[model samples]
Target: MRSFINKKVQTIKPSGIRKFFDIASEMEDVISLGVGEPDFDTPWHIRDEGIYALQKGQTFYTSNAGLMELRKAITETLSAKYDLNYSPEKEVLVTVGGSEAIDLALRATLDPGDEVIFTEPSYVSYLPCIQLADGVPVAIPLKEENEFRLTAEELRAAITPKSKVLILSFPNNPTGAIMLKEDLEAIAEIVLEHDLMVITDEIYAELTYYDEAKHFSIAALPGMLERTVYINGFSKAYAMTGWRLGYCCGPEEIMREMIKIHQFAIMAAPTTSQYAGITALRNGDADVEAMRESYNQRRRFLMHELERIGLPCFEPFGAFYVFPNISEFGLSSEEFAMQLIQSQKVAVVPGTAFGESGEGFIRISYAYSIQELKVAFQRLELFVEELRARKQV
Candidate 1:
């Protein structure tokens, strides 16, 4: 019975982030900065809307494409934020989450042996999703000197006749790097030159902290909207992770095929969540800003503390995580993470969870409270001191 399982699924590596977090979960006392979600509870207004929907017996399935009201809200929000527009009827489909949208986009587009190029040190799903869709996954290593941003030159270098799609994950998960308008403009030219379509995961788009330049979408570029599948959700921005709601917008031809697969597979996203999502998109701006400011404060504190403790970390201006170089401590990212958990009772994610390019670094999330962060760093300081002393011995 075990042998009858799909070999492709069996051979895939387990998520490194979850592996250590599971271990820490069993312990008595652990200060974890490993989970990539908002520490805040979902805003009361949004929860009240969901409660209202349930009271009104909205437990039934929405349209296979999702609620028209939610879809309309999706179009309005995208237009307001990124200047990208889509028709609710034919061009937008709400999925389980941004993760589902990624899978849907890949399955709808890729033929077996088609190539999908993505940046390394990205979220965990891109490679596995491409492989599951039977597309070849190509990783373009992002450089720290470039602040971990994907450059146009890298895009041009990775192109081939087989390259069919690019997975653009920005305001990135572990790295917290974002692409500005000029940065996106340069890449748009190369994408046009290569004749590639894109699956842009902008789930973290609203959480950016860069004061000088705001988050920009490549899909908003001239001539690119038709060629891009844009993904976003309420999880990060509205502190709505448990709600499991997300939406995708793209050309009608692509979206039509995606909705077919989604219809049979998921049928529809949660009706209650769809109702909640409509409220989130309409009234959650102030809530998002409050949470973003909180995360930014913790981010600044962690950055300064890591510098004082002699860990050179890349300064991130987006998202809520910091990728710090831990090479000087003479340990692999996994080793440092495990030993820290055992020795100091603190948990952070190993950067290698993202990709091999993330070796010698760890990802510390700033999504926790300031009190928890303060305690976690205190443990981290002790852990580093002990490691340094042992290396000397």
Candidate 2:
């Protein structure tokens, strides 16, 4: 019998984050800070909307582009939140989550051997998605001293004549780093100079804390709207991860191409999810505000506790995760995470799961309840103390 795995598929390793999560699952009394999900249940009002849609027997598939109402809601939200305007009919494509949006964007735009430039310590999907699309991924490592932010110089250095797209995720995953307007302005200059297409994932746009820095969309910058594909979803802000609904907005030409792929692959986003997403957009502002405030509180608490435990973490400006330097522990990120889980029953993802630049750090999510966070922090403190007593730190 012949082996059947594709050569490309065989080259990809399974997600490092998921590997640890599987290990953590079998351990007794484990308190996980590993997953990057909101702990809140989907708000009752949104649930009622889904239920009402079901009760009305409205289970048919929506249009390939999703419901016009939901698309319009997204258009208005984009204008209100980011000052970027997009047409609901021609410029928006609903997807099965930001994950699908990402896949569609890369597939529609890339040809084999095309280069996609993105920063390291980002969401894990970018490299694999690029590879799946037969695009080459060029990773620009962000510096720890710069708080894991991607600088314009780094962006400029990463681009080559083969560069087809630049993938940017801010309010970043695992690192909680966000780019300020000035930083984005500098990057916008580089993008224009290189004539690069930009795919920006701003799923955590509403979760910004610390500085009052508003989210800057590359599409909103000069000469960018025509070349930028903006991706966002209700998962982080609306606490609707299970809804599996997200959308992409961009120039009509690119959006139409993305829609062609989506229509063929997915048909449309979930009908019930589209309906509930409308409610999430129309009346979920208060819920988003409340959730953001709670997350900010937890973020501050986690930063303080990590520092108190001798883990010097950069102050995160967005997202619900903190990446703390654990180099003092004299263990690799994976080893530290493994020992922490085994000894203290506390689960956190090794920062190296994000990228090579994250090797000396560990990512702890603060999306849990305050009490649960306190318990985890206490365990972590003890674990660090024990390591120090053993001459590990």
Candidate 3:
């Protein structure tokens, strides 16, 4: 078996996010905040559309690129939301989920040893995906002071002559940080200077807490449309996580390669899911806003409680997570999380699970209900009190 396995694949570690999540699942009465998934169900209308598709016997495979109708709808949604335009026939690709789009983008572009620069404390898949594609992974450590936003200076420091792509995930998982439009301009300038392409994941785009503006995509910037792969999906926004639906848009030349790989590897996305996706794009705004409001409430409540408990954490503006500094407790992030689960049955992910840069922090998700959060907070407060008492001794 050792001889049969690829050595590179053997070097990859399993996802740290799932380790604690699976542990909590086995325990009794534990409130697990380890996973970043949404708690909401797929909206009635969206689910109804899927049911309708099945009833209509639309089980046949769609074209390699996906149903034309679904592809066109995806382009319309991007254009209307972010002023991004794509040719439905050539520039857009429907994937199994945002994860597939990410893998596709990496595989389509990277050659052996081409460096892909991405920020640390990012989605767990980026580094491994780069390695699996035979590309080198270059990680730039993001700073808490910068709200976890990637700075042009940090990006420049990581770039080498072989740097070919940059991966950006805003409304970031684990940290919940987001990059505003002006913040993106600086990095976009650097990418252009280095002639780098970007695979921007906006899966959490609709979950941003900011007012006065919708989420901004770097693909919309001047000269960037041809230089970026914009990835998004219905999982986060429409509560369609299990539907396994997502899409990507990029230049025709790049997308052509992605589609060919997809055609062979996947054939097409789920037909029922694609039909449901069309309805989600056209009529799911109200459902999205309602869920966003709920996540915002939970986020605020957790932030206030973390403050009241005297735990220091950065204020997150997007996603449904809070990354709090627990260094004063004098425990490793994994130790704190494990002891909290043992003593209080409240499970959170160690920040170091994201990257080495996430040391001294822990990521708690607010995707659970308000009542569940309130109970978890009570246990968290008690845990902190006990740690303080031990310190005094």
State, as a TM-score between 0 and 1, how close model 1 is to the true structure. Answer: 0.99
lDDT per residue (tens digit) for residues 235-329 in model 2: 99999999999999999998899999998888999999999999999999999999999999999898888877788988989999999999997
Off by over 4 Å in 2: none
lDDT of 1 by residue, 1-393 (tens): 979999999979999999988998999899989999899999999999999999999899889999999999999988998899899999999999899999999999999999999999989988899999999999999999999999989989999989999999889988998888999999999889889998999999998988887788999999999999999998999998998999999999999999999999999999999999999999999999999999999999999999999999878989899999999977899999999999999999999999999998899999999999999999999989999999999
* TM-score of each candidate structure, all chains considered together: 0.99, 0.98, 0.99
The residue-by-residue lDDT of candidate 3 on 1-393, one tens digit each, is 799999999999999889999999999999988888899999899999999999999999999998999999999988898999999999999999999999999999999989999898988999899999999999898988988999888998999999999999998987999999998999999999999999999999999987756689898899999999999998988988898999999999999999999999999999999999999999999999999999999988998999999998888989899999999989999999999999999999999899999899999999899999999999999999999999999
Alpha-carbon RMSD, each predicted model: 0.8, 1.2, 0.9
Cα lDDT of all candidates, in order? 0.93, 0.91, 0.93
How far off is residue 316 in model 3, in Å? 0.8
For candidate 3, the 10 contiguous residues with the lowest summed lDDT are: 209-218
lDDT, model 1, position 6: 99
